[model samples]
Target: MTRGTVILKNGKVFIALGYSNSDSYPSGEIGQMLVKALSNSSDEETVQIIRELIGGLQKDEFSKDCMESLREIGEAFYNKKAATKVGLDDVYGYYYDYSYVYDIKTRKLQIFHFGQLEYSFKKEDFPFLRLVVENDELLYTLSYDTKNKCFKGIDAEVKKVKRMKKAGKSPQYILEIAKSLSERIHYVVDEVYSSDCWPNAVQKGVTFYPSRKRLKFIFKENYGKWNVYIQLPWVRQGLIHNCTSRKAAMNKLIAYLDGNWESFQSGMDLYELYEDCQQKLMNFYNACDQISITKDEFNESVGQIEKEFRGKLIPLEELDYSGWTKAFGPDRAKKEIANWIFMTHRHIFDCIQKA
Candidate 1:
């Protein structure tokens, strides 16, 4: 059997006794037991009963309605005790044991464990109290409201953590290869275009545009792998080849330059292609200045269109008609303008025929 108590404001005391397994004894038998226990019990025994009741309340071992009544009674007891300059040891037990203390001056409840002060809570700031057993030791956690000058039970706070991806170092072999390849490409480009100008040196590689060529050579590290490719004028796609070893890539580049160098001597210039695209786009935008769209809106639409084009190597003939219509609207002039902008800025890989 488990027993508890409720001391009301009117000085009426109620003893709550019950079976631990949710069973109930006959009311007559319970009444007799309570009567016998209190009939000639000592002051120490009565105080022990009250202490057990408060302990049960702290442990949340009662129903919601019963718990609420017990809390009120506890608050009354503590307030009265505090007013009379009586310490919690007189009512609950000795300070050497685990117990709660209410200071009259501070109106704060101090929780102690084996004479060690564990936690303290001001009367106004007291959250719902929860007693938890961790590492075979009893501890308190915060939860619901304490506006009624009593601790109620609720869930404790939960912490969330976000994990990040671990960083890794690049391979030493790959770094060495990239450095060697950059120096080799720079040497070749400088040798080839010595009379005209020097090759442009980028982070991982070099670029050289031979005089009057439709295409330019770009050797660089892309997405961690080395690539030596040919970029064509006014074309979204390029002739790209990936190489793992520096020697293989250099051999391929030299062979392509040897075979195509004569053809590149007389063809469309790279700068002319860029200037033409810029002029056409500007002219189209100028013609549509009366339209309601802002430059930012046009740029956003163009970016979305470019992304769709880059996602796949779709040819000009087999282009998705509905996609661009959604981006630039149903107006024919706007669609035409957006298409031109997309063609100039969109990226392509291995689509040599389209270029």
Candidate 2:
């Protein structure tokens, strides 16, 4: 059978020359030409060539051996241009054994292997191909020797590729998980708030954040699990809760909202402390019957009652307590009642000031 010469320049098959049908491809002049063209071509031209070659491979115009040859040529071109080019090309093509597209604009690289896109990376953000292959114990290995024209370890690479093909592909469940989590978050937010609170008290869309403040409740995927974080204003490291599933994340979010709501109501009650104290004292006295009691018993009862007034003293701090002390002077029962109120109020006031 007659031999063929598929001359690849940069990453593309610049010319395919042959006299007749070929069983095997020639390498001498064709390889030299490819190396020379790759060396001389600009980064943009090389990227375009890679794109076209990938397109051709996807079309299945070449055999597996031919595709491997093309990939080696493409990698050589990449090695030569990688050092100098700040912006790389996103070369899209078919996956034979493995293929990669390095995007020029985004500086992102996507790797396809075993008929699926397996990995993605940012330029300079990851180790070199050979290092990655060795470190990660990848099935196929990359060659760093740019001078070697022929595809190295073709037999072994093909065997590995075949084995990998036999092994069933792993489904990407993270995407489905993300979608489910997003929908669940939207639904939960809508259910928690009334229509009047929408776009005011709570805002929901692609993400959920408090409209009044810079606080944000962010959900993101970490490793294989969903992570929930409450980002507060002026805080670099926000509160984080790592969850194994979407259900756990949603539950955590609901709990956070419930706790926050309760705290908010408690804060509002502080402003009405004076009226609340009066009402509580009136109710307590009305409930009490006119009966003789021991001094120790009355003191013990007052101590129990004082617990209710502990945190409600913010509104009573500025009020004059001297009037009550003077009015109840020399009367043991009245003084005991007045002293209980004074002590509870004073304790809470001291705690608030220290805080």
Please give each candidate's TM-score: 0.23, 0.18
- Give the per-residue lDDT of model 2 (tens digit) for 1-355: 4233232232243322111123221122322222332343365664455445434332333444454644455543223243124332234232233334455555444444323444454444333322233222222222111111122334343333323323232222322322333232211142222222212222222122211121235555566676554332112222335678745665666555544532322322332443355456556444343545444565466556555555445353444332121221123223344565666544533443444
Cα deviation of 268 in candidate 2 (Å)?
A: 78
Model 1 misplaced stretches (Cα beyond 4 Å): 1-188, 191-215, 222-225, 234-240, 269-277, 283-338, 341-355
lDDT of 1 at 306: 40
**Tens-digit per-residue lDDT, 89-196, candidate 1:** 355332222334433344344444433444444433222111111111111112111211112111111000000001121223323332333222211232222121
What lDDT does candidate 2 reach at residue 184? 23
Give me the displacement of residue 169 in model 1, in angstroms: 57
In model 2, the Cα lDDT at residue 111 comes to 49
* Candidate 2: Cα lDDT at 266: 32
| Clash counts for all predictions | 0, 2
Local distance difference test, each candidate: 0.34, 0.37
Q: List the residue pairs that clash in candidate 1.
A: none
